[model samples]
Target: MDLGIDRQALVPVVQQIISAVAQWIRNSGASPGTRLPSIRQVALDNLLSQSSVIEAFERMVAQGLLVSKHGSGFVVAQPSVLHEGQWYEGAEREWGAFVDNPMGELKLGCGWLPDAWRESDDISYAIREVTRTDTAGLFNYSTPLGLLALREQLLKRLSQIHIATHLDRILTTAGASHAQDLLIRTLLKAGDCVVVETPGYGNLYRQLAFHGVQLLQVPRTQGGPDLSALEALLQRHRPKCLFINSLYHNPTGTSLNRTVAERLLELAHRENFLIIEEDVFGDLQHASCTRLSALPHDDRVIYVASFSKTLSSALRVGFLSASTVIIAQLASLKTLTGFGTSRFAEAVVTTLLANGTYRKWVQRLRKRLRTQMAATLQVLEDEEWEVFAKPAGGMFLWARPGVGDRSRVQACARRLGVLLSPGALFSPTGEPSDWLRINVAYAADQRALALFRAMGPARSTSTILKTTSV
Candidate 1:
């Protein structure tokens, strides 16, 4: 194979070699499982040092593009089979249907909790200590209203974010999504209008639709949800609730500005509708304003947030803050639903809050996430991949490929051994986009970056995606 390498090029000899080899593989119509020459043979053919070829091969192997065998040599790697888009097969199965295969550790599409984040010894310690001290509450079923001490702690946090919610009005649920469901159940009836951001979180929308709510699509701009369109929908449909993620909105990684937030609250007041702001990504906000809730004022904003995003995902702890009246209604709805939040989880979280470890951990996490995000962005930019908005504090970057079929690109990424969350997963109809949401937390080092660069671009389109404005 002719590599067409420029020995004088400044792109580093090893990188050039890898790029040439990769381009050749794509153009040659060679299927995966094809084997290449040995390092010594390649070195001889290219008239280069053996170490250069070895380095290139090593890099390819790490990126999942090539696999190495002990006695034989390196061969093309197997293609990854990650599911993309939202297509529920049955009541139990949903988007990205993940079936655990026999090759246990070989997963590429989902964002997993790295070992560093899963060290839950500290969590264990906190839970044990709290259960010991609060023995009485530990044994009984948790109050539907949530533990008083935990509510007080949550209120203190709400206060820090400029949300002046009372302790009595707060209700803790299994997680942010749980809080979302309870609010939806309480406010929306079947066929009621619910405005959602286009290309928003698919599962949240799916949950709302499953409850028989009529969905109205509001186009999202970089500054946040398109207020003009939202106003039109509010007047046209007279919807029951506006489901928004005003800060660090999912998939797009966009947030609303203070001006827009005020205008949104004004519209809600005039329209006489409620706002259910999913606050899963609120902790990643770079702004100074409080997150928009179902009751921003006059008891119209219901604020939902969870520790799953900021802390461990296994700790499914989420809460909602609103007026006493709404809280009472939600509390009634919660009872008819599943059993209340876990006593153990709440007690453990409460313990973490009391000892101040949660705050410390959050600070450390933010710092690490920020660094990792920058590194991921730099790697993408280096390869000239088209990126959407520059998120202030979110953990993901929405990227579009320069050229190729989105599905094919995804297929290629799997074959290359790099797992990517395809853009179509966020959409309701499962329509493919030339975009992908990259989790910065996954690739935090040089090895990860190198793998990213070797994977190439996603499916390119004539109309490119712009960054969401904040």
Candidate 2:
């Protein structure tokens, strides 16, 4: 409010006030506890409505430029910034670096929603409520099975998909990856043979190898895993477990059908090997509710799901649904390893789900994902790239090269500041491939569309990624 008004300018009053306050904070070299003017005073001083000042200050609070106290009013806070760090070696570190700040690079391979797409008001409200009166959330450690209310809410989600599960059989973890880690620790030993989908979740390759488990690759089709190839693997290696994605499969965006699910369970019963279903993208699927966890009893299949994809990844709220025995073992391991998941995070997600905000957000997310998918596919098709399947709803679209060399196309993309995930990363053997997995959410950017279209005959084949490995 220190600055005079510029009504003749095109800027909105709210934005102008925001700009004035931001400039004042920096020019004054405001310390952390420095007080901001009251909303009413700012409104009166600027000759604007209280709502205008409220909106401006609310935005500042969300951006961490200001903090609001109950009765005293708003105070100065540090400015928010994006994550910054040096690149490190490892699949996890590689992805971390890619997302930190891609500059102008098109994130066609990233699997997350852009930061601008999230709904902050509801999250902010939930956080405030938790801090206000959330005793169980703030003071006590979460039960090994996690907050009952959250687990019960998740049980309702499971029921929606026809997968009947009880709270006693559910154990919460840090995320889906943590769930998988617990399963690996409890069920299998070193040198154990594990059936992994070829061209599947890329990071799992390193994780399994790190645990000293031998991987048996099974090629996945549009319906599911190639049953013929799978049965042969079971016959050859007698593996202990199979990790599969049934709905909106990662890197491929393919789903499994009832026939495939039934056939898979039948074969599992015949072969006596367990299946770990990674349905992390289940909530975002367009259709098809057939799950290995839904079929028969829960003896042979373990289901892992998370809120990371649809909700905030920083929260890390995920759970495992399986038989009572498996759940007990997982809960014990979770207790031994980390004691418990964050009670506050679980409570926040629980509130979102129970209040119906989370479902509405997921529905909106699905719609956005579908739109992005259609647009990405159209661009790829226009370029004569061969898509593996038409995904109904999901983040990924796998395709093979049609008009350009895979290596050269990727190299050219890098030069244009476009990061692309080549097919070789998805495969267990790391063999060269003509395929690429384009994340629909990331591809929605115009830069990505232009990048895909730019890979025509005009662009040169030689570039930096020609010999460099991902």
Candidate 3:
């Protein structure tokens, strides 16, 4: 109730009061559940009208920093601004929810590749083939360096992806996610600064934040990252690593062109930081032009990709190709962490590769994805949604909700049993946005159309008005 405001400045009286009260609660060592001052009492103490105090409290509640009880007035809801600082623990909670009842609900929330898109069939055939040929190796634990044959296959694929790596430079993990985790554990220390793209993949964001690495963000551009902003950040922070999704960048679906790729590589070289390229969606691109890759046979690039989107996410076959120095460190880290990827799965992947079925599977899946992407795009375009249509390849369509409150859009999607990923989840502060990241690989069903209908108006009038005024 002791909150005070200065009327001399341009800032409104209510905002000053709100900030003062918020800071007081923060500094007072009060628990999150501690009740805040009553609106009337706050108004009286600050010599402000009751309406102003009420509006201030309402704004705080809307921001999720405060919670109001029907009988008790407002209380601090989230006392700590830990969304950015401790995102991994939060991500763990979210994943826990996913696992709790995965198929029970229409889980459009997480960007999971459809079950039919997985390599279960290909994997099954490989397993059978491997069992028929050699059952002994399948049952045993893989070498710390991974199966030699699987490593060879991985190296060959890396060469096709513009990274010329030897078996010695490739290491296997349980999944691409595992590779990323191991890399962070091996190379980065707590509090090390890591730069990621704004509106980036939340899992990576969570993992980096969870490990206590300071995250710096550069805005995503039409073709790649905002280079000027990235350079400015490079000048200011000099981060330890730069994590990028160069080919079909996540959430935004913007691929890096050759020019953008060269600039990014140049920055990484000058900054003395490694580039962690997560190209999980590289195989899904339908375009004839090959997407750009950070691995230019450079030791500074740690290339990582998975079968998560291309094949079966459950197959958990992810490879890392880097310089001998990093590959050695990451291998050691993998040994200490999960030992190695599944031996049976590696044997299966090897068998499939040897048989040439893996390529056929990718061709079929890519064709289907291209068709689905078109259908998805048609539906969205029919709805007048704004998206980057030139994304050469990827499952997702990065879109802005055009003037609508993203939270409202999310809520509407939920009500229609079609969940969407709100753009705020991609930001450091979980700030609200008009953008939404959507996975188009999932068949565009009537349910999805219904969900869009729930969005009410297409453009947010307020947002358009604000822009006009600006």
TM-score of each: 0.75, 0.77, 0.76
Global local distance difference test of model 1: 0.69
Off by over 4 Å in 3: 1-90, 97-104, 288-297, 456-470
Given candidate 2, what's the lDDT at residue 347? Answer: 90
> Looking at candidate 1, what is the lDDT of residue 273?
81
In the range 34-146, model 1's lDDT, one tens digit per residue, is 78888888888778888988998897786566788887788776533112232332212212223432212223234433555654877989877977787875677778888
What tens digits encode model 3's per-residue C-alpha lDDT throughout 1-470? 66535454333566556556655665576777889877877788778899988888887676565798988888887645424233434444445444553223344446666665565766777778888887866678888888899888877776665566688888888778888998898899898999888878888877887799999988888777889999999878878888888777778777777778887778878788888888887776566433334336257777888876676666688787777888888877777766666888888778887788888888887787677777777766666777764466567777654434543464344333444555666776566567777777653655566555444355465643322220
Of candidates 2 and 1, the better by TM-score: 2
Report every candidate's CA lDDT.
Answer: 0.69, 0.78, 0.70
Write down the RMSD of candidate 3 (Cα, Å).
10.3
Please say which candidate is ahead in lDDT: 1 or 3.
3
Question: Model 1 reaches what TM-score against the true structure?
Answer: 0.75
* TM-score result, candidate 3: 0.76
Model 3 residue 328 lDDT? Answer: 83
